[model samples]
Target chain A: MSTPLLYALTGAVLWGIGLMGLIGLRHLLRKLLALNLIGSATFLILVGLAQHHNGPDPVPQALVLTGIVVSIAATALGVVLIRRYFHLTGRTELESEVPEAGRDEEGHSG
Target chain B: MSNWLMAGLLFTPLALATVSLLLGFRQGRALSWLGMLLQLLVSVGLWWLVRHEGGFYYTLAGWDAPLGIELRVDGLVVTFLLLTTLVASGCGIHAGFYLEPDRPWQRYFWPLYWFLWAGLNTVWMGGDLFNLYVGLELITLSAVGLVALGGQAEALRAALRYLLAALLGSLAYLLGVALVYGQFGTLSLADVAGQVRVSEHALLMRPALVLMLVGLALKTALFPLHGWLPPAHGIAKSPVSALLSALVVKASFYIAARVWLEAGVAVASQWMAQLLGVLGAVAIIWGSWLALCQPRLKQVVAYSSVAQIGYLFLLFPLTFGVEASVSLHAQQGITLQVISHALAKAAMFLAAGNLILAVGSNRVEALAGVSHFLPFSLFSFGLAGVSLMGLPPSGGFAAKWMLLQASMASGQWWWIMVLAGGGLLSAAYVFRIYKASFLERDEQDHFYHPDRRLEVAAMLLALASLGVGVSGSQVLSVMAMPFEEVQ
Candidate 1:
């Protein structure tokens, strides 16, 4: 129908795909990426939808903008954690492969 | 003056948090406690005023909704405000002892803690979708920072996963708001509800709902989307974990419930409600089973959170189609469950933190002689567990009873079974901890001694859970007052 509605549908489909990827993937980084993708899709949909209500709904757009900034901050934090996990246990998956003593020194297993 | 009060209530902690960043690692503990004390006082004063006045609403900069921001102070918001402040106070005091004075990361923890507090308060007071989004982001950023504050390898890793999940959730919620805004041209909850027209665009509305619900579900850690929680919560410091579990997760659920109610979406297919109930049932069963299996004491508590979240989800089916008296009862039950869980879970985590400090290990099996060393902490832990198990004279029991009645009255027999099963599972995990704590030991081994002050804080919260149970009728009356006009 409307262009804004079309964009919203596209964003929704992308989000669905991202969620599926997140569930299907085993790699921690891949899961994070999928989550990021899904987040972007949601933002796109929201911004697109806001376009139809008026010339531009600053409130929803502002909210989504805030969401993007926060998402980036969260992603940065996640990346740092991933790096540390790789350094400590030499693995990214949460499930443990190391011995109990090794895990104690590194701080966690799962 | 009202606008100033509302603004102060929301921004003061945030300002303090940012200022603490300048003070850095050296005075982190001192500043944290100072900030927390101020927050506690403000929250208490606000609670008293709201209780006396019934409720209050502030239009930001004297601008009305659909044009400018609005912050509403009601019984529900005040109740949550009280819980957040109490937990922050306890955590602040306990952290002073829990953290080593010379630790490098203490600098970051204080600011983030306050920032989280600010975000939490904003969520409680926020009256519209856009304001909620801002609140949620502030919360997400600060919470992620706290997770990473541990600075250890696992803490960093857990923080990363947590951040990713939180971002995804925010995105979905943002998208939903955009759709609602495009259709209705308003971000205020009441405005959106009044102008909502879902007839012409079934295709658009369905997807929007799905995105928002899925996003929030991820943030709330409702069963299937809960992959990030155990690791993130378990690896963080004890006080941080306590705050995250007890208060942070509840924020997303509160927003979701608010949207669902305010949107007045014609109770989307019965299947959706059933699906949510089914997932909730699974979470209750699965979370308990996982908690029972965890060797680490903190992991056990973390997994227990998964099960506890299930009880919150049970509200969906029980409250569906509920109107008038039944709606009032459901609302009361849900609010009680939320408040009771916050108190009990925070106490449980604090007690567990004490035990871990005393025993010098997080392993449950190694806690054989902890009761001898930390008797007060253990006692409080048991009290909290009683609430968790939904036993008589506890708030958990009251919440469960109300939900059970709602289900029966609605002819939803299946949900009754789910509730009973969840309660039994809750009892099993709680008793597991109790059994561990009480096991008789041959040799008395002296481990590290925890500070008496922390023990007192944990015990106080545990007692609050019991108090909520005893005063259930009064608390429900307060929670019901604001909603009466809506009905």
Candidate 2:
């Protein structure tokens, strides 16, 4: 098997794992990490797939660079929002994740 | 002169965003007024140029396509550009008076607003797939910032959900772009379309098209995936909600439609189009039903947006596999729907804001005695509602009329029923608001009158929505102009 094809297959597998984590995780922080993993997987596949066919390419590499910067910005913004939410509500999980009794306390606090 | 106009169209919002960040809110307001006037002129100038001179590609920084970024200044794109200028300026003018001037956090609003505007223009003209992805992120970040500006608990929660959903959607789209580049060895959408037309192995790229469409559909908040939209749109300040519902969501949908129209015919299956159409129909019915149940005024408006967006997805089924004339009618219909919905929705949100301001509460029950004190804003809301309900002499009616024609011509009678049912459901919710306001409550009059400018801002948008119905033919004529290929 070609080396680039192997890399692209790895990316596809990682993308599946990241999707599962993002969907199954309840904690917002974990969810953010899962999103980051997905980002890495997408970038990997982009570079791998482009290079697998042709010998070398600069365009996909450039796209991956931009994608990384965008993901970083998104993560930073997510952290800020999550921190503020935690400070206000004193909880890390979303409202739907909490049970009935916890929601009552939340209603009172809010 | 035209080159300068294009440059101005691209430069003004970004420059003003930077300048606005440095100044105070009031100072930013003053500067933004001048900036908006310049934008309006530039947008209109470009629209006129594209109409008369034909559409052409503008290679950014002298770099050609498939290698560097290019801006596609076509009939449909310039039409959206003009629509953005009109709707965004209305919201901007309303925000100036509506936001509390003394609050320190309010200063951030202008910068975010302009950045969102810049992002929107980029998406409209972006010819390269990667550039559109960047544009989508720019819009998502700035919009999330706007929603979370005050940083209250509920606002933060809504903003977080919005951020997550938007990020996920963008990544899905980027994944598709990666596959397309791998297959075609080019990131330019035009180049990919050209190749897909001639290539025998085009079926290999069908998964890529589906990924992109699903991503954009999620971003557009099409049904079942629309969970994140209401909380974010409802919780944001009125002007922010206006911008979000009217423009931000449409940006993603515009890209999706462009992709589908350009290359979908070659690679897409019939079931995919039908499935999209089914989802759109369900969104219309379910979203309107949910809108009717919301207790808060703005939530109803927000949910209404979800329903209206469903109308846009109908473009997919109506156009795919249809005759050329049928598809043309469907395209014209959807374009009118987008423009009219933007104007009417903006008007409704601004008017609802004024109503909430007058009553000092967001609940529908609290609006019991509002009609007596604030007939003007209520009337504006109702006028916008008329358009939403697809009533006569409104832009929404004109759009639905063409859609009905296209569906009939295509022998797809089922979508016709969906269209009619969606309109009736919308009327039910719109009237619910009216009913609540008309109930008499015996209490001392404690209403606060909003600024005259806010009322005027909303009233103007409402009037424009009605006017678009009369001028629908002229707009369609412009959209029919031929494209001049890249040199």
Each prediction's whole-model lDDT (CA): 0.78, 0.90
DockQ of each: 0.40, 0.44
Return the top candidate by lDDT.
Answer: 2
lDDT at residue B372 of model 1 (Cα atoms): 73
List, residue by residue over B1-487, the lDDT tens digit for candidate 2.
6678878877889999998999999999999999899999898888878878889889887888666788888888888888999999999999999999999989999999999999999999999999999999999999999999986888888888888888888988988988898888888888899999999986448988998998899899998788889888988999899999999999999999999999777788789999999999999999999999888999999999999999999999999999999999999999999999999999999999999999999998899989999999999999999999999899999999999999999999999999999999999999999999999988847899999999999999999999889899988777777788747
| Best prediction by DockQ | 2
Our model 1 lands, by Cα RMSD against the true structure, at 3.8
TM-score for all models, in order of appearance:
0.90, 0.97
Cα lDDT of model 1 by residue, B18-60, tens digit: 8888886657677667767777777767766666656766777
- Prediction-by-prediction clash tally: 3, 0
TM-score of chain A of each: 0.80, 0.83
Reference-based lDDT, residue B176, model 2: 90
**Candidate 2 lDDT tens digits, A1-110:** 88777877898899888878877787889889988998999999899988855487888888888899999999999999999999988988766432211121111222
